[model samples]
Target chain A: MMSANTDFTLAVEELTVSFDGFKAVDNLNFYLDKNELHVVIGPNGAGKTTVLDLICGKTKSTSGSIKFMNKELTKLSEHEIVRAGVGRKFQTPSIYENLTVFENLEVSYPRGRGVFGSLMFKRDAEVENKILEIAKEIMLDHMLETEAALLSHGQKQWLEIGMLLIQDPQLLMLDEPVAGMSVKEREQTAELLNKISAGRSVLVIEHDMEFVAQIAHKVTVLHQGKILASGDMDTVQKDPKVIEVYLGH
Target chain B: MSFMYEKLLGGKNGTVGFVLLATLILVVFPLALDGFRLNLVAKYLTYAFPAISLVLLWGYGGTLSLGQGIFFGLGGYGMAMFLKLEASSPENTAIQSTPGIPDFMDWNQLTALPWFWEPFNSFTFTLLAILIIPSVFAYLIGVAMFKRRVGGVYFAIITQVVSLILTVLIVGQQGYTGGINGITDLRTLHGWDITSDFAKNLFYFITCFLLLAVILMSRFILTSKFGRLLLAMRDKEDRVRFSGYDVANFKIFIFCFSAMISAIGGAMFTLSVGFMSPSFVGIVPSIEMVIFAAVGGRLSLIGAVYGCLLINFGKTAFSESFPELWLFLMGGLFIAVVMFFPNGLAGLWEDHSHHIKKRLGFITSLFSKNDTAAVAPKLEGSN
Candidate 1:
């Protein structure tokens, strides 16, 4: 028990990634407790998304380790890490444009992931009902038959979140889930995020302070690949270093 | 019921397209063309196998391979090797210095049969080799490229390079491969005289039936969950990867599956055409095979078959009188398909289908109203 941080859903320690003599993420230590909705806010080029990429195994670290569920994630492949119950949403809306909303959700249903498994996968009532449940949860039930290409910008964002939600990942890392959303859409998204984070660890990288204050249980401000200030939203906002680097701008 | 129909066959429209192609090949071509011409069509249909495969790999899987001819040639050469060996019995080759070996090996001054060629003597081995050999080759290439994340045009160029290497290997090793002339003088398959007109006709029907089955198999893949995943991976590879899929595995499976399909066509090509040459195993034929897929409708499997039939018929027709201009025309057709008709022939059909239905009001009345309503929005959405 002393060897592992079982209380934390994710414990990233001494993580560093260097490219061409420049360390993009430099020995950063971050931790998330169970059911904690932690937000990472930083200016552009602050290695915010890089941290997400590192945790999800999209980008390999030069040193240090990322432990999730007492399992070292840095050594696993991207899909292997994902299969271990960690879902990541990109900053941009990355839903499949050519697929229908139903198909887009169905592809992420977390079953039949292997090549042969997918070929033999039958769409039973369980799958159908699950897709329907997620679609409705994401507020895209009416657009199930509609192609994702026709969805609005906000709807596309929700659909991307829906894609991650269907996986039922233990740790959900979202990169700016409301970047292009309208006020109404953002409100719905905040509510959706709140509902989903009830029993799971949620890590978000957001720029919008209002949305951050809306959904964040705790906030961590990153500056140049290192944590500058980490605490509740009020504490992060009041930190002189955070105001100087990010919030002031 | 409509969903069920769509599930089995692509949609109601696809069912029509399948039947239409079926009638054109099975019923119409045999009734219309003579034996010699029909055999020519059979040769053209072999190219359709690669074209149909491209629709699955390039169109749906979104991996453009310009070296399908390599797999086709592998299949052709495998069959040709067996046939050449069978034709080179001690009794037939008693005149040669070395009997019981391929004549080319004898001409090149080889005394014994190569160890590798021994297994090919069995017909069972040749049949299995047609499916397994190319799949293994494709699997190797798929792992080398897809695992390393080398895709799009880079992947295309590597496949072309593979075809070139295969061609050089075949032409360079004259004795074992029969060199540039290819392993010719093929006479029989399992003691049946394949050179006979009856055999040619039987082979034609076999080609058509085999092609239909291939199309159905490809459709089954496309409609399955794996099919949707392929399309998703094509559009958003990162998303698919993050969605808990080993994306490389999917690409490898499709590539191997696509290679096997092309190899089947290649084997048929040897049977129908009586020879496998380096000319058909190089970069040129490989790219030409892609043109067939592009012109047919890269997205539509049935369209790929028609594309092959149409382009190959044109190649045979124009090359006879204006051989010098045919290459230019082929090049021009590929450019035109890429520049303008990105989706190819079937795309045109889908785009204007509603209009065509409306124009023929009397005929369209026979179709269900719900079908038209169902497909109308799809047009505007895809484009």
Candidate 2:
């Protein structure tokens, strides 16, 4: 199912992913608009994270077409997909724990990606300022020199986000951005996501309905590898199928 | 000056450590040791190349190769071939059936120089072959393995097998490669007899200089951003890949780079030892080379040099007195270093560096009572 539309930032048409005989994501159709903050909500085993994996090219789709900015995504590898301006933060806080917070962010800086480029790369004023700016944005300015493993759970999540921000991708996809965070951290992350969404599209897979309601411009409910409902949060929450399968249960 | 010191030596204490090492190798060793001892030190320095390569490959890049000896052997053979050809000049080998060919070829009843031996007649081509051949092998292995996601223990095992294969091949192909004895009777390099004591002394100085230069180059890479990326990749491969880097390319480059460095050491080894042999191109020597890096601090380039020197010195002395016990002692040393000091000597130094600095300050204070800037904190804190 190919989408002829070029207006959408990300368009997935009839996406299906299967492991052995079981379908993880089946015939999924989704689209993300420019500068939109979209949240995916679902019950356990409903494939909310699978959709993200499919989008980020972490899982190969059995049958589908994923077009990111009018370019076919299924043909590209994971790193190529990332270079194509899609940044994904995993469910767990995946960060370089041994390195300092500053080093973690510096790794994701868009420049010096080439082998020789990295060799010649200097921590010049521009790079230093960018790292400091991102550190400040993530509220980690004071801890830039601290090792990442020492960061609190919430801080690690933010550090991973800061890593993504350093790259400044056109689209940011986060899986469970506030799963293990405290209430205060959740609130801070919501604010951070809102600020970041000003110039970029965000696709968040979140189970916390309260967190979703706080920052989501639109929400989609997935059930057993398909989009059960899609609309504004209020409308989708009230829908009978959405209530029966997800929120009500 | 401070920036340069910090960048080159790692930090203030690192500068002290670096200076101590430089003085020991460059100034102290040359002056204190006799010619024979000096030549022995040069031989030890040759092994340091493989150890230093491990600092980059296994220590920083987290790519462990168990077959560095293969690269070393290839490089040694490359140099040996040239030396053998030079020594077997038509005038020198006039008594043999093959007057222009290496004596080994004549001994094996070959009347003609083999096609492969033709290029080694030129010293320049041999030098190029030494640097490039092993790296090409490493590149192939790296691309084949890393691209397909074969790594960790599996990579180590494959490299070990490669060392075994090369050893067997060199031993089996006696006529072509000088067999198990290897390419011996290497007399001269471009008409200068390398076996001469004066030439040995000169080569010793050259080897020391090259080893020092390698340390500097390694230090430069370790301090660079690329080095940081290697650390990043070692910690989290997936994250680096997701950050838009072709991870295989980095692994391949590092493996090839390590091979080239090991090759340099191998060439140096042939020059100093005066022969190349299959005894060096096997699993045991390969594993021993890794131990040198491990004991010296696999993460520290300078430490690798010291490790190579210390272990070789120990092996020479220990084996002479108690040959059977030396093997057991070596095994014990490996286990102890692995278990007790995972980071090795450098790690040990780093752990107590503050105390060492304080002691240094205290010693200085005894000499000059007003030297409070260095010892004030310790003195006041103690009081």
lDDT of 1 by residue, A1-249 (tens): 124646789998888999888888988888899999999999998899999999999999999989998899999999999999999999899989999999999999999999999988889999999999999999999999999999999999999999999999999999999998899999999999999998899999999999999999999988888889999999999999999998887
Best candidate (score: lDDT):
1
Candidate 2: count the clashes.
Answer: 0
Estimated TM-score for each candidate: 0.95, 0.94
**Which 10 residues in a row give candidate 2 chain B its minimum summed lDDT?**
B374-383
| Cα lDDT of model 1 by residue, B200-233, tens digit | 9998999999999899888888999999998999
lDDT of 2 by residue, B172-262 (tens): 8788899998989888887788999898888887888777777767777777777888998898888888888888888898889889889
Report model 2's interface C-alpha RMSD after superposition on the true interface residues.
1.0
Displacement of residue B83 (Cα, Å) in model 2 is 0.5
Give the candidate number with the greatest DockQ. 1
What is residue B343's positional error in candidate 1, in angstroms?
1.3
Query: What TM-score between 0 and 1 does chain B of candidate 1 receive?
Result: 0.92
| lDDT, candidates in the order shown | 0.92, 0.89
User: Clashes in model 2: which pairs?
Assistant: none
Supply candidate 1's per-residue lDDT for A161.
Answer: 90
Q: What docking grade does candidate 2 earn?
A: medium
